[model samples]
Target: MIHSVLEFLTDELNTFIKLKVGDPTTTRIYLSGVTNEAGIAIPDQSLGISLINIEEERVNKDQQNRFVNAVGKVEKRNPEIRLNLYVLITANFQNKNPNNSSDDYVEGLKQLSYAISFFQSKNVFTPENSPGLGSFDPNLQKIVVELYSYSFEQLYNFWSVVGAKYLPSVLYKIKTISIQENAVLEQGEPIEQIFTQSQHKS
Candidate 1:
């Protein structure tokens, strides 16, 4: 489910960028991170969406785990876990010439700005609004994206943990992904009546 959500975002953002750049078949946005086998924090001349953190949304939890099935049998299942993913989008574009790297540097900033604009225009995604999302995961009913701000210290710590230098980037909080399993922990037949025991006075 997490993979599907990220892929959906990447595809949507990539389309928006292609339209803005007036180029078809332009693939720039991708699901990636600073830490990779190649040790490249950011790919050259592309935007990488990375999952930086995940937090469980503890508010408004459903504790009810038992329900009657269609066959009138009692069934018990664990409640789903709701999660919020902190995603970082980084743009890394560098020119071949180290001396003339300013152009690519600015280009990276422009790409990053495009990402911000795309999310600003449309932050909430539902099946009604985004039909493609249905193909990704029918269970994915809704997704909300919000700009996440960070303090200078926090930013520094993040970059340090990533083991890479900072690039033009933005952070977003992707909300409310549910995880549940179908295995029933317990099952039983529905009780139809209550039995009473009678005893003599002695």
Candidate 2:
């Protein structure tokens, strides 16, 4: 499910970038903070998306449904593991410009602005908006992407925790993804309602 979600985002964002850059092959997206098993850097230099955090969603617990079979056999399943995902999208363009003016920082800011607008304009991804998403993971009903803001102190700490120097990046939260195990914890007969006819008083 995680892979599918990321794949969907990667395709959506990169497709936009491809149109903007007028190339589909070169301008691509990569999963950020990734390295080969041999400790070698992977090929990148496009928009990079990296998962930063995941939190369980407690609100969906009430949505789970108890099952009663045809024979009035009752069964109960645990609530789904609802979760929210936080990922960082960083412009992976080269830091150096052709003019040799060291405008990489400026380029990053510009790209970040563009990315923010793209999300703002269309923040919802679902079967209706993006059919490919459901193909990637059928269980994915919808994905709501929202920008997350951080204070200066928090940003500094976040970068420190990432163990990398800060780059031009944006934080987005993908929310309400859930997973339910099919195991039935309990099974029993459904309660029967009995109606007794009152005898006429004589």
Candidate 1 clash pair list: none
Residue-level lDDT of model 1, residues 1-202, one tens digit each, is 9999999999999999988878778687889876775665556778899998999999998888988999999999998899999999998775655675533788788888999999999999999999999999999999999999999999999888877777778999999999887679999998889999999996
Q: Evaluate model 1: give its lDDT.
A: 0.88
Q: After superposition, how far is residue 64 of candidate 2 from its true place, in Å?
A: 4.6
Best model per lDDT: 1
Off by over 4 Å in 2: 34-44, 63-65, 69-72, 94-103, 194-202
The lDDT of each candidate is: 0.88, 0.74
lDDT of 2 by residue, 118-198 (tens): 789889987988878878888888999999987889889887765655666789998978787668889988778978888
TM-scores of the models, in the given order? 0.90, 0.81
